[model samples]
Structures are given as structure tokens and as C-alpha cells.
Target: MAPNDSAQTTEEAKDLVAGRRRATRYIVPVAVAGVAAATIGLVPALAASGDPDLPKITAQELIEKMAASDTQQLSGTVKINTDLGIPSLGGLAELGGGSLAPGGERGESGSAASPDGKLLELASGSHTLRVAADGPDKQKVSILEDTAEYSVIHNSGEVWAYDSASNEAFHAKDDGSGTGPGKEREAAPKDLPTTPKELADEALKAADETTSVTVGGTAQVAGRDAYQLVIKPKQSGSTVGSIKIAVDAKNGVPLKFTLTPSSGGKAAIDAGFTKVDFSKPAASTFDFTPPKGAKVTEADELEKEKGLERGAKNHEDFKGMEDFQGLNIIGEGWTSIAKIEMPGGEGIGAPKDGEVPPEAEKFLNALGDQVDGKFGSGTVFKTRLVNALMTDDGKVYVGAVTKDALVKAANEGK
Candidate 1:
């Protein structure tokens, strides 16, 4: 074979591997995010006009109801829309042979792309999710795109993830022990704030002198009666306006969540169920078998051991980090800020000596404004809903408020 041809083949192989990894990263979070949203009964629909005659409830009463909400067998379809205002990386789909393209998994390689392709689909537009829960431990979530579908089924201690586009599947068995490959099998980070109830709980925990909670009113979502709970940050520097959650009137489950920035024209992130059914999904829904000729990866005992070791090391490393010591919350509730002292070039994938990679610097410059302050030179990345400030001095401040809030937090050094 010609040398040039060999080089091209090698490059192509690298791209394929990278594409697979990207797809896994993108698809898993989305599916798990769907489950988190679904677990809280966050099915989306346009909020119905307010009902003045509905019984008005206090904020404390609403919190109690949410705490006591029933979560059992249920199924629903959710719609997720996110507009982060980040420019799309041009030709990402083409570079990966349309593997990241939305709708109909057809790619230049004549194969269905992985569910990660749906990331491109959701980045700019809307997507549909179907979720069902049999109990706390049994659940299924499926993401349906125009031409591709990704489904995860967990039942009877077995978990299976199938991608229709790639004709591939992954299987893992939970041996009732929480420590193993089954532990690493989770696609989404357990710490992500995905659900309305979870988000509300976090906010409530942070609510202090700087925040307030109020009952926003009553409305209907997905044909079910719901009461609106609103959380607002009192700090003037906060860029956040308020967060609103629609709680199911009957069960106290949250049906929808919306985050609106203080200077906001629109909700930056809107996720919820578009439709829902209280009826339990059939048992067959969780049943899955790998299709003929599909690639399969199973998590055996050895693999489980390796996963356990990696998790242990990761946990230990996190605990051993001292750079973040003395970190404190700057504000409370929706606009709260958290600042951490980072060692120069020590963050994940960070370049040495506090140097920013050219590509990343360019991207950050485009997305935010550069500034110098007592904390050091840094860039403040701002979006409709969140803001982050990273300094060359190895400090990081982030908040769901606005750029000003992040800046304030950065200036008030620990």
C-alpha cells in the first residue's frame, strides 16, 4: 500500500475512535438527563394560562408536597430545548462522516451514527425523549431523533443500552453490590443537576439571607394541574432573575422547570415532558436482545474490578486536592457563586504554566469578555443562564447568575 494511503487510513481510524467516544459522552448524558427529568415527573408542555380560582398554596406548603410526592410506575414523552448561544463547530458532522448529524443516522460512511450524533441535533434544535419508571431501580429512557434512536433499559438487575444508528449494544449486570463495572456503567455524572426537584432542593439548601422563595401561581402542564414555585436570588449582583418549577398538584411531582436570567429575554434551558401517562409500561418494554451482527460489550467481573479501582483512585484524588481549600459560597439560591483556588495548569486537560491552548483561548475570547482584576487576568464567559470566570492565577469562579456575579465572586478572593 502507498505510504500516503496508509497515513490516510490511520487518520480515518483515529477519527472513527474519537467519534465513538464523543458519541458515548453525548448520548449517555442526554439519556440520563432524560431519566433525571423523567424521574421528577418533569414532562414538558406549554404552561396553560393561570387559573385564579385554584387554591393558592404557600411556598413552605409547596416544598412539603414536593418532598412527599409519589414516584412510581409511570411513562411519558419529554421535549428538551437548549440554546446556550455557543457557535456550532463547523463541519463537525462532515468531519466525522455525518456521524454527529441530526435526524436519520445516515452518514458518509454508510452506517448509522451513534447516539452522540444526537448532540448535534439537540445543540441547536428540539428533541424528543420517552421515559418510563417501574420503581426506584427499574427505569427506561429512549431518545428518538429523525433517523436514529438510543434506548437504555434497566430491569431485574440487568442494564442494556442500544443504539439503533450504530447497531451496537452494551450490557452490564448489577450484582446488588454498588461497587463494580455496574457502577461505571452509568453514562451521566451522578452529580449533575438535571431534575426540577433536585434543582429546587439545591436551591433551597442555598437559600439564606440572599434568596427568597414564593408561590408563583397555578397552571396546567401536560393536562395535569400544577402549582408554580419560584425561587429568586436577592443579591443585586446576581444575573439570575428567577427559577420556576411547575409542581404536580396531586402528587407534588415537578412537571417542568425553567431558568430565566435577570437580563433574560428567554429561558436559557427548558426541559420537561411534552406528554405523560400514569399507566405502567409493559414488561416487554424493558426486554432487549442484541440484534444479529451487532457489536456487543459486556461488563464481566475483571472489568468490574478495574472500574472499581479507577473509581477509588478518582475519589481519592478529589479528596487529596488542597488547592480548592477554603472555598466558600459567595451568594445563595439561584445566583449563588462558588469559587475555587486552582493550581496553575492543574485542572483537567489544562495546559502547563497556566497557558491556554490557542484554540480554547480563541473559543473563550469569542464567547466572553477578557478582564484583569485583583484575582489576575482572566476571561469571563457569559451566557443567558450561567457565567464562569477563569484566571491565569489559577482561580475559578462560576455561577448560574450573570457575568457580573461571577466577576464579583472572583474579585472577593478567598
Candidate 2:
């Protein structure tokens, strides 16, 4: 099932966080960055070596070259393998979030390509088969799983994702939406981290030392010739200074990429292009139709709601029964100030205050003393605290903060 599926979101989040505790998701991200860096930096050196005649190509050029072949409608199969590393779940783990594990099993289907260079087809997975498109960036792929599940219309910078399961569609400016119609390309760092080539350029520029060598070998897959290219990292502390990619010598596409981490781990990713059909794909592949009575919501609003829901769920999961039981009400006609005060005198949670309330400060200080310092490392006084305190006083605060100080202040009843 997809990670976003209702039943799996919680469990997936759990497993993902656990995976991070193992190696911290750095393996794949760094590897990706390293691959680009290594290629960008090492390719030149390789070209400079005895094989001086090999044409000079920029990292971007290489990517374009791989993507450039036969722009006029071509079809093939794609087998994508990604080995990613997740970080520890210390506070940042959930904050940094995690990546979706590439669905297991190879995809098989008759695919087609369009004149505009779009590849569309139905993919067969172990459980559910998804049909999607490889948008302009290739990485900007979209899942066209159920035409009936979502009503997507792209026009004048508007985009929507209507879910058939819940009967609600999320809306956001097309700029943030990938693929789909009228969506603007997002900027980098913010955009899905740059492609491998961009990372390669960055790595090459920053590399302190460079060397060139041609490790010989070639293999044929999908009727394409692939070459083995290896480049080593220069810095001792670098996560991955070395990378190897099996590039399709004939088509300029990559079939395999190997990353060696500085921490002594090995990861190999294989991408297979199968069922190649160069015929022009259908024109309706990009079209989408909405479902009936779907609730429409802006993307940011959905995100805000998701965050709030997650936070509330987290509070229920972590907050002790004693927390709610201990507090009582006071005040005649006064409304309640529900704030999430952490253990330390740090930040407050929900119902953000333009100015810190006196009770919030006291609550944070009092809570701070209890945890002593289990929240985080630099978090000796810091702790994850949610304060939803109500009193006769007109004050409130919520969210992450230092628990110790809050505890201290609350106990003194200051």
C-alpha cells in the first residue's frame, strides 16, 4: 500500500523513524549528492587521463544527453531502485521526516511516449499497479493511479488533488504541484533537491583533489551498451567521496549507480528500462477528471490541518493521563487558555502568543525541572513539551519547548 494510505501512515512513519535510528538517512541523500559530485568532479579527470579524446561534457549536459534521446515519442520500461538512509528520531527525525521506500517488485507494462517527451503507462506492482507520467524532469513523476479517485484540472496556475477515498480534494498553486497542468517549476533546495548532475557539479567544484582513471568494462541491457565509471573521494571525513555509475555508453542513460559511504557501508541502486516501444503515446495520457461532491481545500490549509491533527495525535500518544487529570478550572465567565507548555522555558505550542503569557512562562519553567534533560543533547534543559493550561488568568501558549523550567515555575505555583 502507498505510504499515504490511511491505514499505513502511522505504521509507515514508525518504521521509517526506526530505520533512521539504524544509520540516519544520510546514506542515500549523501550518496545522491556524492554521485553527482563525484561524476561532475571525476568525469573531467577521467577525460583528462590517457583517454584525452573523450568528448568534454558538463554535468547538466550529461543529464540532458541522457534525457535528450529521440524526443519524438518513445516507450520503454523503467525499474527504479533507491537505497536511502534516514536520520535518528531525536526531535529532528520527525521534523526532517523520511522518504518513501521504493515499492518492491519490478514494473511491467506496455508503455508509450508522446511528442512532447512524456512517457505514460500502467505499472504493475506486487499489490497495486500505478499508472504515472515521467514529466519533463523525469523526477517530476506523478501517480495517475485512479482517474476516478482524483479530479485534476490544470489551468491558469490552479491544481487540485481530489481523493476518492475521503471525498476531499486538496488545492494549491500549480507552482508547488509537480507534473499536472499549468504548474510552475519549483526552485532548488526547495525543489526536490537538484538532480544527480547538479550535485555532481557541486561536488566536483568543492573537491580538494582529483584523479583520473578508466576502469574498463561494458555490458548490454535493454539493447543498450553501458560503461563502468569509477571515481574516488579526496576528503577523509566525507560521507561518500567515491561513486561508480554504470552508464549506457550508447544511450547516455544510467543503468546502475554504486555509492561507498565514508562510514564503511555499500549501497547499489539499479534502474532498468523495460518493454521499450518507441511509438507515439496517446494524447489523453495527461488528462484528468474530478469525482463527484469532492470537498475542495487549499494545499496549505490541508497541510496545516494535517500538522495539527498529527500534533494532537502525538499529544494523545505521549501525554500522560496525569497531565489532564491534575488540572482543574477556576474563573466565573472566563474562557479557557489552552496552551502546550514544554518542560523547559523554551517555545510554546498551539495557540501561539504574540507576547509570552506569565502563566506560560511559569508552566514552562516548572515542567523544565522534571525532565532534567532527556529531551535532547543540547537539550539538557530542553524538552518536548505541550502545554494546554487554563486558569483564571487570560494567558495561553503551546508547542515545543524546554520542560525543566516550565516544571520548576509550575511547581512553585508562580
Candidate 3:
């Protein structure tokens, strides 16, 4: 190959890798939230240690056990391993990814390394979290990063989030009623999902659809015996091969979770507890006083300064599916492709000048292969589990399905 051609190929290879990261960060949280995040080549031997002999339980019984779990107080160390299978954006995180790739109509700004993009930071790589909850009113989660710590604590009506790297803290006061938009906004992403119980809840909800549920046997988790709840989609369109949640044999709390993609060699997601305690964490665990030098921001004050209505602005955010026009679910069950309209009737549009931004072009080119069909030409972002088709016609058809499945869904919609 020519030198220029070789160099161009190398750049495309990098873009492909980074674009996959962006896609997984942007899509998996929404698409595979119930199944698992877009896991790539992380855990080569992530399968359970060994299958232990345990009393057999029916799928319904296992479901009931998980649903009936009422352990409201506990603390644990959660280890999360995942790979988005895309290249790292390197510096393109500021390409307005926080809000746009997140599938939001609202605009928000942040660079990839900034703490403001904490939630987006969960998109790739491995993560370790310290999570504790005392019933519903008192909860705390600390994301332990390499050089920084991101902690959020909710004690009664006060919610405090502190980012050690940035030396900034944010506070929000809840209604104490533990419900409504305030509650939703506080716990939605701020908690940063630290336990298998969290994903297990979503998986069980998927079971409500056309899925098969069974017990895959028992295994050891956090030094406790756990029954593996195996869930598989009954349709071929879904890219998810199978889901396994290990439930505490005695209490039913999900102790470990794994998701195997349809094209899997090893499991994509392998999250489990390294240590756990059922005892209520000390009162100090939920208490927070911003460090001496940390700059603090109050949610209410910010809303007031911006002249934004709490009820209205927050309601729009949660009403994403309803407010995001042209979004439709094509097909049924786990194979469903959520069709979301590209913002501004453009494919990651640039300014009003009518030109594709260079960064945006690179982002798309790196994300996936180009395809042409009755649905027209578009980019297909592929991972182990989820595939998203960003059509030339300002629409995105995404789901845990194959590239062909996305095309078919787009065509069927057309």
C-alpha cells in the first residue's frame, strides 16, 4: 500500500476504536440497560468459577425470590469490567457528546476528562465503586477512579455530590417524600449503579417481555452461595445471547451479573461484589460536609440563577422518550429498535453553515461500517450486543440486534 494509504488506514483504525467507545457510552446505557452495558474484550475468563449443586428452583420461583427481596440495608465493593469495542475519542469528548450522543434534545457541555461528565465516564473500561444504602432515605455511592474520587451521598432530604479531582461539590435538597421529579433526577444517574441488584432489577423487567428464564445453577459470590438466574431473549434479532444474575441463595439479592453478547467469546459484562455486608452502614457514612477548599454549587440556586423552573426543566429531561419526536420502537420484545430522530434534522450537524464538522465526520466514520439498503445509506455502529443505524435521513434505529436487523427495522418503518 502507498505510505499515505497506510497512514490513512491507521487513522481510520484509531477512529473506529474511539467511535466504538462513544457508541457504547452513548447507546448501551439506554439500549442494553436491561441486558448489560456494551462489553467487549475485557474478561477472557469471566465465566463463573464453578457450578455448585443446589436445590432446583423454577424460573417463576427464582423471579419471585428476586422480586420479594427486601434487604434494604447493605454495603459492598462492586467491580465492573466492560469494553465498548470502539476506539477512544481521545479529545473529541468535547464534540458536544455529553448531551448529543446521550440522546438528549437539551444541550450540555463538558470535556471527556472533566468531572461534570462523570456519568459519561462510565461508558468504557473498568470501574470500582463503594456503594451503601440504608433503606431508601439514606444512600451513598463513591466512584473510585485512578487519581480522583467521585462520591454522592443522600441523607434524608439532602443530596451531596463531591468530585475530588475537580475539588467541586454539588448539593440538592429533596422533598423528603422520596418521590417525584426530584427523586428521579437525584437517583437516576447520580447513583452510578454499583450493585448487581441494580442491573438485576432491569433484567427482571425485561423478563416481563418475550424472554426465557431459568436457573443455570449456583455459584460463589462475595463468599456467599448464589443461584444464577439465566435470562435469554426468545428472538433472533437481539444481539444479546444470554444474561446471568447470581442471587444470594438465602436472601435473593443479586450478587453478581454477566451479559454474554450474541457474538461473544467471553462475557461482555462481569460485575460482582468483592466484599459485602448486610449490616446498616454507620450514620457517618451518609453524612457529608464539603471539604475545606472545595467549591460548592447548589442545585436550587443554579436553577434560580438560570431562571429555570424546577418542575418544567426536570420534567422535560425525564420525558425524553415522549418529547424526543420521531422516536419509535420498531419490532417487538427484546429485538425492538428504538428509532430516534437525529437532532436538528442533520447527522450530528455542524453550525448553520451547512457543513459536516470534521470531528463529527471522524466520529461517524470510526463508529461503524457504511451500509446501503431500502432504508437508504447510513452508518451502522456495531458492538457485541447493540447495533445502531444512523441513517442519512436524520434518524437512528438502535437496539440489541444485528446490522441487518437494524436495516430491516428501518425499512419496515419506512
Candidate 4:
């Protein structure tokens, strides 16, 4: 995105918006900004130091500066921390039938990245990411772990996601989908937020009626002087308290992004760089060669192998729920709730059939609490910023709003 003062820049901004919509499905949209209706996963970052000395700038100006930023080459270390307040992260993997991990479908043994893996890894705790970019077509993001690394590389229109521990890789061709690694994000697990800009882009997507934007002040992020652009929701019922994007004072690039929950203690999601470099990374940084023993899975092969497993999905793995009917959006803007129908039985119970495993059943029982409302009784999963209500009839309502909001949406169908 660039300065919308000119026609060229306006077009670029629209393009950026469209490009971003295509590139992402995650970090847990949490009924926030219409990112997802099923579940919201917030990506957190390390906190920045106190405010810094900088020239005064308005919120609109900072947004413009960030949109106009054109940093095409850079390398940096990004720290991702998320605490959605949900317990038993390993239960999430079992819910997915062990398909959640990036490339470790090989067996049910070993650490496997996470019990807990790939997308699950980004859902909580702290992760160190090595990121680099040279122009729109070349870039790399690597998640460094104790004994393994997961990486996503885009070079000359080819995309590769490799998991070192699993010794497996996923490969795809860009096909001119869109600029930024997110264009094909839904297809691969590593398409998560690796930079402040990526997470900040989500906040920018808020509808005008739902957002109130302002300049929070100045700060130093990754040693760079930056301006904080704060966005808050206008309506009631949203789980998000506010979003703060730290924009580099000089380059206009976003240096950090944090989303504080309305119930607020600590930020539910905080993401930013601890170290950064604007200079281009060496060409070798994007060059990737699969290890000899690595199993390479092509994009098409992966898609066919795993249906709906490519992205974070609702709990439809329960027995007798064959197809995920679809989603219904209730209300609008920040207060909106996402309604989806699950075709199975009254409750997420031990399946009479083997469609779901024992662990998944156990997870479902533990993750939610039994509750009854005007709409009826099912279960509810509550976190700092989002609430979910699964009705007895198999209707699921998710939103950043309160549990009452979800129940209201279920009853009124509004």
C-alpha cells in the first residue's frame, strides 16, 4: 500500500487490501475484523520499551505513512507470543485428527513440533522467527525451535514450506495469486504473522463503522523510533479493547502490533520485531533444498490428502458430522457474531462411530462448559477476547462479543 494522495497510490492501497484478504486465514481471527467465524486466535508480541522522542504526527498521517511504506528488502528476527487463555493446546491437535502439525503426518510418535504443532505452535507461548525479504517475489520466514525449524520460502514464484523435525516439505508455485507470502497463506501452515505489518494489516481491515482510529504516541521498537496508531471499536460487545500498531518513524513500516482485550490485563496478542535490518538478505536466504530423507509433498497432493485441514476449522470431526454446511454472519462490524451449523448430534459426545478419536472427545468435554440460555443448551468456550456457544441442535456461534451476544444471535437470527 502507498500514499492515497495520488490515483496510483489509491489503486495500490486497494490492491493491498485485496491481496491481504487472499493471503490469510489465521493467527485466530476470533470474530474480530471478520477474519474468521469459527475461532479467533490472537498472535502476541513482546512488549516494547517506553515511548520515545519523535515529531508529532496524527493518526491519519501515520496510517498514510504506513500505507505508503515501500520497504521491499529487509531481514529481521520476529518474536511471536500469544495467550488466548485456552487450556490444553495439545487437545487442539487431537481435534484435528493429528493433521494440525505441518508435515508430521508420518506417525503418532515423537515431539512432532507440537502435541501441538505448526498452527498450534503459533497459538500460544513465545516463538522466534527469522524473516527476510528481497522484492515482492522473494522472501523467507523461519520458526526456530530447540532442535528443529519450520520455514516458508517464496522465491521466483515458487513457494516452499519445510518442517525440519518432520523431515518433510510442502511445495507450490505462486501462479501470480498476489504479492506478499499471505496470498497462498491458507494453503500452508507457516503463513502466520512473521512481522508487525502482517498482524497490523488485520486491524486495518475493520469496517469504518466499527473502528475509531487515533495516534497513541511514540515508542522505540527494535531500536527504531516509531509512532503508535491505535484503533478501537465504536460499538459495544466486541472482545477487542484496541489495536496498537507501531509505525517506524522514518520508513513508515509497522514495527510492532498489539491487540489488547476489552477485559484487559495483558495484551491477548502482541507481535513485533526484537531485531530488524532494512538491507536485503543474501540470495541464499531464499534458496531452499529439501534434505535427502525429507518427504516432499506437492500443493495439489496436500490439498487432496487433507480436506478442510489446511486451515483452522470448526470441530466437525465428531462422528456423524459428514459435511460442514456453511457459515452465517449475524449483525455487522465489531459486534457481529458468526453462526455455523454442525450436522451431528445434540452434544459433542463420544462417537458411536470411529469418525472421531477418544482424545478429541476428551478435549471437547474439557474445553467447553455446559450452559443453557434462551436459545438452548450446549457448551461455551470463553477467552479474554472471544466467546463461543455451541447450541444443542448443533448450531455454533462465535464472536468477540460476550456469551450473551452469541446466545442472542442464535435466538434472533439477527
The numbered model that scores best in TM-score is 3
> 1-414 in candidate 4: lDDT tens per residue?
355469888788799998887667553454465554322433223343357888888665676677557788989999887878876455655655545564334342223422225666577777888999998778898899889888889898788888887787777887755454445644443555334444345545544567888888888888888898888889887888999998899999898889999887888889999999999799999999878977777776555555455334535344334565667888888888888875554344223335668787677768777787766676788987789887766677889997677767777862
Q: Residue-wise lDDT of candidate 2 within 1-414, one digit each (tens)?
A: 885587788888898889887676678798999999999999967653442224444444454445444343444555543332322222332232322111111111100111011111111121111223343322112333344332343433545444454565555565534444324433433465656566555555554244232333554445555565655643222234346665556566565555544344434233455334344545454444444665555666544654665677667756643343232332111111123334333323222344568796665455433232222212112211223322223222222222333333333343
lDDT of 1 by residue, 1-414 (tens): 466798888988899999999889998889999999886664332234545356878787788788656567789998877766644432446554433443233423222323344456566546688999876567888889669888877886787778887786767786753344335534343656445566557657667467788998887777788888987877776766778998888888788887776787877667787787877788888888889998765646424544564577768777757655646677665667777665544563223343777786676577768787666677777766567787765667877766656766777763
Clashing pairs in 4: 23-182, 27-41, 28-41, 30-40, 44-81, 44-269, 44-270, 45-270, 45-271
Better of 1 and 4 by lDDT: 4
| Angstrom error at residue 10, model 2 | 72
| Range of the 10 consecutive residues with the lowest summed lDDT in candidate 3 | 103-112
Error of 2 at 151 (Å): 12
Q: Rate the local accuracy (lDDT) of all candidates.
A: 0.69, 0.40, 0.74, 0.73
Task: Rank by lDDT, highest first.
Answer: 3, 4, 1, 2
TM-score of each: 0.66, 0.36, 0.71, 0.69
Q: Give the Cα-based TM-score of candidate 3 against the true structure.
A: 0.71
lDDT of 3 by residue, 319-403 (tens): 6545457667777888988888754557342223236687867765876788888877878888877788888777888898988
Ranked by TM-score, the better of candidates 1 and 2 is 1
